[model samples]
Target: MISRAEKSANYLILVVFAVFAITPILTVLQAAFGPSDAGGGGGFGNFADAWRIGHFGTYLRMSLAVSVSVVVVSVLLSILSGFAFGVMRFRGSGPLFYLFLLGIMMPSEAIVVPLYFDLRSLGLTDTFWAVALPQVAQSVAFGTFWMRAYFRSSSRALVEAARLDGASTRRLLWQILVPLARPAIVTMTVLVFMWTWNEFLIPLVMVTDENLRTAPLGLAFFQGQYTQGFTLLAAGAVIVATPVVVLYLFLQRHFIAGMLEGAVRE
Candidate 1:
């Protein structure tokens, strides 16, 4: 239905955008692996120095713990809540669903202050839970909305057949729906991992302990201490970002398919 000229124009635009998006990353990579001093050749020394100086080993461990915990808790809660909202009928379901939708509409900046105070009141400040819990809440909100849409749009005939087979409600979800929802689940997991991994503001505000710092927060402090060392800084940035990049690379196909499917349904 499209002309060759239009297709060419679209391709040109996409290529331009891709270059725009990739230029900064390429620049970072160059600086990360480029010459460190006046005569030294490029190598991994900068990364080693950065890692040691920044105490990124501890920061990385903290990040992994929080991110993995948030993803597991958020995904499980999202699945249960999403399934209920999508397929089950109950009193006040519409209102409750709308309440969860409000979470997606709310920005973190708007609630982070109150959230910090509340956590502090509970003596959860300066703890890993301080950083992880709020993010889990936020991720679960979006995940529920995402999975609910997926379930709601699933084939009614398939659900009916499951029911006809005398499958219990739990079995219908886990044995039948869960397998079919693998793409959506994978997509949500990737998204939650990326968000939780990259979070900064919550950790910065809630945790005062140096050991509890996450990668992004640690990178900020590292930058402050090594403001003049561009090579080390670049390497640190790459180290912080590599996990999410690798994750996306591995899940690109499933993520793209899930996104496209969601779009088509919408």
Candidate 2:
């Protein structure tokens, strides 16, 4: 139960946050559709022009390719590595796990110079794999750590039952752990998708060719080349942002549940 004053305060806080969140978005939306001479000769017209001129359709396709590939590779690698660390005991496993954890603390920028040089040496610079492989490597650390925690926290009783039934490692993971960890898997998938979709710096450095540019880099190019057409840039921004926002809205429940229930008590 709440008092009238408390309810008023709560509503006031909600209003404040709403303004904070919506103001820029509304401004962009308006700019996206405003009439010409709304400060520039370009308006929603600019959006259509940019989309066609910039070949944003192709860029959108390429970005989706990179994002989906990153998510799939990252999730698969995380699951395997996490199961190894969580369920399989081996020599030096603790140290190896800590080494993976170190990735979480380090910024990707710290190794960009070396990474770029390495990719160049491998003839991978300007390739889709250049952007994707690094993202996979970087994301793997946290993804494995997260999934390992989820697996460890899940029912040991079930694991024991499976073992008594003579379940092999593959059987346990495929038949038991994977199904039970669906919530955590979905959360990690969304997180990886969001990260890879929005990733900019690595792609910017590695992919010098225009055809290989990710959406964020494309947005940067749009902003730079079409400075007067703010509406087009705004529209582009909205296009890039919409998919992840929709995904989050859909999977937010599983994401929350996974985080809450993920870590094992040791």
- Compare the candidates by TM-score and give the number of the best one: 2
Model 2: lowest-lDDT 10 consecutive positions: 257-266
After best superposition, candidate 1 residue 168: deviation in angstroms? 1.1
Model 1 whole-model lDDT (C-alpha atoms): 0.86
Q: For model 1, how does the per-residue alpha-carbon lDDT over 14-119 read when each residue is reduced to its tens digit? A: 9999999999999999998988852334568878877887788898999999999999999999999999999989999999988887787777888899989998
Stretches off by above 4 angstroms in model 1 are 1-16, 38-41, 254-266
TM-score of 2: 0.91
Q: What C-alpha lDDT, on a 0 to 100 scale, does residue 65 get in candidate 2?
A: 97
Best by lDDT: 1
Worst 10 residues of 1 by lDDT: 257-266
Question: In order, what is each prediction's RMSD in angstroms?
Answer: 3.2, 3.4
Tens digit of per-residue lDDT, candidate 2, span 154-195: 988988999999999899999899999987888888777877
